[model samples]
Target: MISKYPQLFEFIEALLPDNFSQSQVGMSGATTNPRLVAQAVLESPHQWSDYLTSLSGRLTEAERARRLYDQVIVEGARQLHPLWISSRRTLGWLSAQIEGGEDMDERALVARGLQLARLAPNVMIKVPGSEQGYRAIEQLVAKGCSINNTFCFSVSQAAACLKAIHDGRLRAQLQGVSTERARYVISFMIGRLGAQEEFARQASQRRLCLTAADRRWAEILVYQAIQALLRRRPTPARLLLCSLKIDTDVQGREHCWHLQRTGADCTLYTLTPQIIEFLIRSQQQGRPVVPANGWVQVPKRVLNRLMAIPYFNQAYFEGDLAPADFASQPAFITASNDAREGTQRLSAFVQQTGDGAARPVIPPASDAPMEHWS
Candidate 1:
């Protein structure tokens, strides 16, 4: 498949394990979120039993959850550190996401990001793509921290983050701080974008004839437009495509639409283990046809029908949304809420664990040279 569909290899595989050895399978990087962490905690409670027991009982459930989240990311990064060093920091990055919720302010995000950065050099902190998130991203990057702008759905969000990253890199350079190892990425939740119902509602109101094909191409057009926009200027941040979903054609052949359509693009794709399995199993049928150009040309009729919808219009155009409009998008809101729920569930689960094994208390994270903010 690597020889046939080389584009599939250009991914920063998601869902990291404590002992990550999938690098041999063409995984260059990994990412995790509250949902992924919660899944991990549930899947391998025994692997973390001793570590969880070491956490102080005095800590709140929320605090314990955060600690567990960070520990998992740190362990993954540590395991990948050898590969990172061997590759001279070109690969083997693990993205550790901070707490996600509407209530996460800039100050708290920056503080959490700083803590995560100090845990591992190869860790890239994942920040939300809201207005405050962009501010935190800029501040953290200026302090020599790697960043991954996540929960992003529109071109405007990606553009804002690119500017933030560029400005932050400039500030870091001026401060004589080295960001050579600090890679940056902007994630496009393509699957979530497609799943949003706002487009259909808007089309209904406008009396536009929307079809399944139009719905499918909505995010693909947006992603291609963002890719073109990003390439128009040089910036340190790379565009990452995530939240990929699979679909079956009329002939009943399974396909990951985004990968089949634009997997050849020179951008990072973050695939979960399930998606990876789908790709591996898909090989049994034979090599799927992938387009030579990652930038897909939307059909004229499909574009005409989709342009009638306000959500589609906003998503397809770069300037339709301001930085302030990012959080209100249905896709962002749903994803953020899901993350919050995941975190809450994880905290409750941690509190309910019956493991009574007492172990040596894990010492608190050592303080790095603290940056005094006036």
Candidate 2:
């Protein structure tokens, strides 16, 4: 099956939320460039059909499948933001169907995504976070489209998403497309979210810490995005949370807490069916959603401090996390993750300051170093 559609499969694989995902994998190839994207769209009719045929040897056109999806309620709601990516696992048949023509897979998929955009204000057309996808995402945004900047692994991808939103909007406005409806998001997968497992592990070896602060880098982008949206506010482009893989020991609340603190009307979470079900399961299991005062507030100052926490630091949660867990990941084994043992190396940094755990408690100050403002 993999060999049958190597390019398509790889393209889709990059889209799927994974245990370990990288931005490089997300933005690779036709997924990034515009010309490449147009080519994929033109060819999707046939390739999409081929992909579907591979699945059952008798699937209908992509349009039919999408129409069937219309009433399904698929994975909405939890997916606060809509994604517009072409996936091998899910949307792989796009290429073949597009190539097939009159069969109407390409038009159907694009139209369907566009049509569905109306239903959800937070629609985010997820491309492979690549050139082709990025191009498409940019275009969609100009068409008053919303985007889910998929395939993000590193800060670079985030930066790229921001630029694409701007470029896509400019192109649309220059061409007079009334891109006022255009919007975009920078989706950074949360759990199992690190670029590599080695990153998580190396932080452990270095006694580097992990904190909501580490994840806060995204907040800065989000805040900046919020500001940009306010100034230009092209359909309110935003920063979103996607690919949320949970770490049982971490006990963090990615969105619930974030929404509370940031009150970020612009953000949303695109949780997969699996992730949605998992969160449901966790909630049913009697896990507390918010610990203090029954709710968590996400003030900008808090977010700012949280963002200051550098990446790959495991020391932040060394006390919270078992060393074995860190040792098991590739980053830990390779000892190559660039973990930042926060400026405040004191153990006191643990337990407080953006600890995302459901019921996180700050450690006694006497036990650790005082958290610094710088």
Candidate 3:
């Protein structure tokens, strides 16, 4: 809207709280260049016959051109924060880049990324846990590079990342250098498979079939992976949950709350704005929004089930995707048709847990009022 009607920005600015955001927008003028680059890439695949025709020159020249194009993308992502911060964009960009890679060539990509690192400290290089990307991650981090580990679903991916961090930390130690924050963030994409009804139904049935394999998912695997990494050599690496399928199991007479009520720790959860709005509205309506008793536990039954699945091998996931790409699975569409709608009250929770096998008890609806969980 601001791009179409510049005057509207003035009004919008006035309405916004006096913040640093407004100041930045004023300082750096906005343009549609990034969109054009995106369009160019999209068009290049099948739409731009002329460009393809024009580029069919010597092999040496073509390689240089490809490197230049990849640099543009890396730098563009570097400059634009939050705009392309979503896993979808980051994942898509990384996917497309790799799909276009020839003969497993990562030499040029690494060089370009290294150049961009010198450009800005806030910019983060995004890579996957693949052998190629892993190598790039280590080299970059060694040179004080920050990176996001995209497309990680299994523990092996986490293990590889942990090694990369340890290796970087070792290199830094040798060089007498230090990093302030986590040089790498392992992205644990959830909801991809759990989102779809058919898949969920099939998977639920499948879960019963392969419950053992399912136990090795994000929370448990990541928790264990973190411990494994910390044991070798500690490096700041956080597990970020993304593409959550259950924006909220804010359903049935019983709202399914999976997150533990434990105080904030290393774990991170990412939700769409839609979910945030829904949560806000729910609180307004006096729904009981309670956090879980503890972080979701990977049950022994689930661990056993995971072992049954033919393709659920933990080692296979350490490399590129086998048959299923975990990053793309948020199988089901979100449940809440209207994030804001006539809704039932939230599931009840007890202020205290009961003794022995007794479950925790929720306070009476009348006893408590509205408030943020944490």
Candidate 4:
């Protein structure tokens, strides 16, 4: 059947696995985390078991899990490799994160980043948006490695990511490296903001009544501001919108409509398989949704109200918000908690795979020297 919403399929085609050749959407990249990996294993045990069995006799439990994780990610990169080639190295990459560590130092982050980047040419090292992550982003970018700065909950964090990318590009230029092949993405977790808002409302016993769409708009405005800041850069990195939750048809329609209205360049929307299916169904049943000819305009009143809030200002304007500040934010706190739990689950999975394995092997530290950008 022909797609009613070709643009939506175009976007999906850009991000899906290589075998999905229905459309030629130019998705810049896709990302996978520990939770996502675990989910895939659970949902497709037969497919994953063969891969897991191959590594059973050769590695420790943790090592086996890590390798499987990398294997899956590399496969994804392979699927998206065509886009990378077609974009002239500007897009079509997959991201793999450094597992098991919550607070890695800059050096450690870089070491892990380099290790993950080595898995595939199209694999982007996914880093958390901690201060150390920012430093690692700069270092990796300088070395001409693609980086995806993940867990960015606030606008300040997003700005920090952009600054790091800019600095790294400059350093790459100095080191005689061609940055035309380098790409970076700052991801904003969309659905989590509404969850956070709800959490905050319940804990404080204050009813700051706002719909999920309202909360999402506030988050989008922050992204829009970041996009404005990036316009100043000679070669700006892409913005990725992730963690979209579609609970109802209306919500799904709204999400699709908003994406259609957003006319930003090099922007990517990463959807779960369920959401992608939902969009496909929506398009088949509903009328065609066309891409907006212009950028979606945020109401000045809404923007002003969001800017006036202290937390919002601190997050979007200061670019120096502390980790503690993020702890108080519902969305960030929830994500952190979820990540820890996900790690524990992976560890359990590793343990279940018995002790009949080879000796533990530690991945080598990256010896790449840090280049300074003046």
Q: What residue runs in model 1 are displaced by over 4 Å at the alpha carbon?
A: 1-25, 289-291, 354-374
- Give stretches of model 2 more than 4 Å off: 1-124, 131-136, 139-145, 204-235, 245-265, 272-374
Residue 315 lDDT, candidate 4, scale 0-100: 51
Candidate scoring better on lDDT of 1 and 4: 1
C-alpha positional error of residue 72 in candidate 1 after TM-score superposition, expressed in Å: 1.0
| Candidate 2 C-alpha lDDT tens digits along 166-214 | 8877887888787644444565444334435444454566565645544
lDDT of 4 by residue, 240-293 (tens): 777765444544543453456554655667755545555566666675444455
Q: Which lDDT value does model 2 have at 222? A: 39
lDDT-superior candidate, 1 or 2: 1
Worst window of 10 by summed lDDT in candidate 2: 91-100
The root-mean-square deviation over C-alpha atoms between each candidate and the true structure, in angstroms, is 7.7, 19.7, 17.2, 7.7
Candidate whose TM-score is highest: 1
lDDT tens readout by residue for model 3, 7-83: 44554343222441223331121111122233333333332223333443454533533433444445444544432
lDDT of 4: 0.64
Clashing pairs in 1: none
Error of 1 at 131 (Å): 0.5
The TM-score values for the models, in the order shown, are: 0.86, 0.39, 0.52, 0.78
